[model samples]
Target: MDFRWWRRSFFGAFLSWVFFFLRFSCSDKACAAPEYTFVKEATSAPPVIFYDYIIIGGGTAGCPLAATLSHGGATVLVLERGGSPYTNPNITNIGNFASVLLDRSPTSPAQPFTSEDGVYNARARILGGGSAVNAGFYTRASTHYIKKVGWNQKMVKQAYEWVEQVVAFQPPLMEWESAFRDGLLEVGVLPNNGFTYDHLYGTKIGGTIFDKEGHRHTAADLLQYANPRKITVYLHAIVHKILFRHIPGTARPQAYGVIYKDAYGVRHLAYLKRNSKNEIILTAGAIGSPQLLMLSGIGPGYHLRTHGIQVVVNQPLVGQGMADNPMNVLLIPSPLPVEVSLVQVVGITKFNTFIEGASGLSFVYPLARRLAKRFRLFLNQSDYEPFKVPPEDMARAVDTVNAVVNRTLRAGIILEKITGPASTGHLELRNLNPDDTPFVTFNYFKEPEDLRKCIEGMRTVISVVNSKAFSKFRYKNMPIEALINLMLTLPINNRPRHATAAISLEQFCIDTVMSIWHYHGGCQVGRVVDKEYRVLGVDSLRVVDGSTFYRTPGTNPQATVMMLGRYVGKRILQERYLSRRSKHKN
Candidate 1:
């Protein structure tokens, strides 16, 4: 009766069975090749071509504009740097929102980068741009913002309807999102503007790009308006520079064409129709637009000269006044599993803060643990400064930090974004290389009021979590009180000496706050572009993306960005028609 031998034999059999199961369970499946009949590969495009309009960066604004222009009978060419979003399953599925951003492939639709101040950020490189990668929240710009920008209200409303028909939807509120909505209302963020797309104060459930089936309909879908025969969309076409020609007696340079490279590294030129009032428009995002402008020698004269680029225009404000909405996130672990959801509930507090919540098993288990560990380190270490860490260490730190804040798998996240902040940052060219990303410093919390508002937001989150609505779920082992105390330890500049501490609030913000990715300005109206959305100091060049925003609206900016694209497209068509009529009269 050898009991030990029997036990060892049982253990060996169990191990062998587990390995056999894994071997079969992990077998790879062959995937079918994706078809992209709507888009043309850059390598197949002619080396030199002409179009009635050459739109660079087929993104959020670019896609819609190309569709509108082509529908109006103008021959359009859209040059996009990233591949088609249709074939990327990570982008097409709403459940993979966070995972899509973690894609670090060289040609990933979402390009990840660290800002100059060491804040981890990402920009959309695909045809649909941010709309393809962002958390599916959708809300129109505030009426105040629309009037401030002086847009035609009627046209703007129509534009919103046009976009909503294609990409916007009303998400079904599940258990987690329902609880969040109740919590927001319990905290006095009242008058639940139920299921409205308008940007109003107080709690509201806005529109989403995710339909009932959890599928994402992106702005790229709006390309249906494009006349297929009239529009030529070249995927993986990276625009290097806007070709400008000097006209005698004109004070500014005229943008005539653009030089770009295909996916195969072959160069090509796209020119505007000769003897016609053709234009080259830049619909690149906030960072890409400013970076391209500087690369084309349209930024500060001194800065361009230092980079050995010949100055075309001395626009000092071209890369200045860059601003992004700063975000602070608090994770609440629960014993009960929270239902999966995106942003279906929002709290618009009186203190100028926008609070949104989401919870679910959205991320892979391994990634969730790594992110939780990183966040614990970030909050626990009082002296943690990402900039001081080495590149390798900083990357690990950022990954951990971003994983917790950005993903909503296994825990609930309360994200608070400052709707408006006076503090602003600037973008500068790192080098003359077109492949180099611009240096972004989002001088967050530089203003004392900014920190005060953020503190108020943190307190609001505590109130919402403690409310009766979240009573069912038990709070796990997070040191919520300790985190709140750390926020209170921040030094107030104007407060009494005893009330203030040696650790300045500004530094705490620099260590904790991250970009919510609602970037705007750099080429703003009244400074860089006119009210008509045309880039100043350059003829036939317009910026029709978020970069042209006078100020970042007080909500998720996708709706407004799309509205502006439609608005500007209508204006361009109207102007063209008027010109033709005047010529006939002459």
Candidate 2:
């Protein structure tokens, strides 16, 4: 009762034990609790709990579907394996979007894109999914692809409108797009009809420079429309399995609930509980969508059997028909040193100070897209040969680039072209477990056309850069010494150049150049899901992300994915999952 030493020592020791107990104490049974009973709360009896719909993967398509369906007053639970988007700073910053590609760590382990064989491709893994962490580039699909995907004008146009509203897309401001235009013009590649390239179906192609706020807009901004009570977006909930139950007598089965793990590593089951009544939609993008289905026994028989996973349905197309737009950037030494960081092409530079916040290179999409469209239309009308590029298309592309260069003083260029052949890829289950990353094989250049076009495009880039106009920019003498060193290190270009004492463009491409991080394709048409995006053999499950593309678009896939999400959401809403649930009330 008397000592100051006793008070300090005994009380401090007691508090330490309390802190340790609170931090680490937990029942082994609770930590390893199975799917059910984890969330059990005792009422007068076992409380009846049910959800009208359960959606796994709160990614690009999943978020929208969850929002749209939840608005109907039915209980909707969105299970995302990643953490809450609120904590991620990089998720909202447009500049950091591209940097996410460079991060291949475990917290955001790089998802398999290209095969372990040749190409390099990177993907994002967070709550907002890829949208939470992707470059803010947006482009709608070409008219040909839209029609091929089995969408009529009415449906496609409607989807476009939905995308525009959500992303707040607009033509680049004149000042913003002007630098890009100037750059093309300086090189004499400007198109005659102006730069905004709108297609036959009104879909446009061009880069997004400045956003509507006069600030840059990202997909995180668009997907965040699910706010307050409308949508319950849960993060750090990785879906382990999609619970399915077959019709009592029939062979067909329907998905009803999802079993997932929470942040605390506690597993919980949001069971449908109703027999053949609830709907489960798999909007988990191309890669994840197919992988999840296979985990649940819904992919190619041989592959599933080989992986030791029982095949619920031998849907051969489950992970086939993958396609991605092969991206290549042509680089040239600029006469003037760019003070801005060029490590990766991004951000609002001082050049943006000219008009409407900042307008030069950022706002040129409208002008550029218009020109690309006219050229595309002209090519389609003529007898187009892949290997033999028509003189007309070449001249047109050259003119477009020249016009843009001259307009923007920012020289030393890299023409990014999506002209390569669209090769298919696949994602097979590497393991029977859902949590494991699957083996993805892009098989990028499977077709001869893909190889030829890529080679041709590289040659075309060389021909233009080595021309008379660029040679005068003090660049003739400065022949990318760094690139030469790279070529020497790698045997990608072993053959002799066209001339001696000078490196040719073809050599640079074959050696130093590599694929842009734009890998796409895999869960494409005829392979992954049907025309409506419904998995061919499964009921109520679908894929609606870049993975759903059969042939990669000639440009970026953001706008196309947005359009698909809207299209699927409308179809689901029109069909009304609520009405189906009402029927099960009895």
The TM-score leader among the candidates is: 1
Q: Write the per-residue lDDT of candidate 2 for residues 1-586, one digit (tens) a residue.
A: 3543332232222111111110112221122111221111111111223576677776666665665566555566666666544444444333333334434455662343434434444455665466555444545566777776678768867776665654533333232123333333343343322423232221122444224322333333344444335444456666777766676776766676666766565667676645443467776666677888888888789888887777788878777765554434433324443322111111111111000011112113443344334333433333222224456645554454345444342333333333424556677777655655677665555676655555555443444445553344324433333223212232221123222112444333333334443455555656666776666666656666767665555344556666666677667676665666777995
TM-score of each: 0.84, 0.68
User: Clashing residue pairs in candidate 1, if any?
Assistant: none
Which consecutive 10 residues in model 2 have the weakest lDDT in total?
A: 348-357
For model 2, the stretches where C-alpha displacement exceeds 4 angstroms are: 1-49, 84-86, 95-99, 109-114, 169-220, 223-230, 273-277, 339-415, 433-436, 463-474, 479-517, 577-586
> Model 1 off-target regions past 4 Å?
1-38, 361-409, 476-479, 482-510
User: What local lDDT score does residue 306 receive in model 2, on the 0 to 100 scale?
Assistant: 85
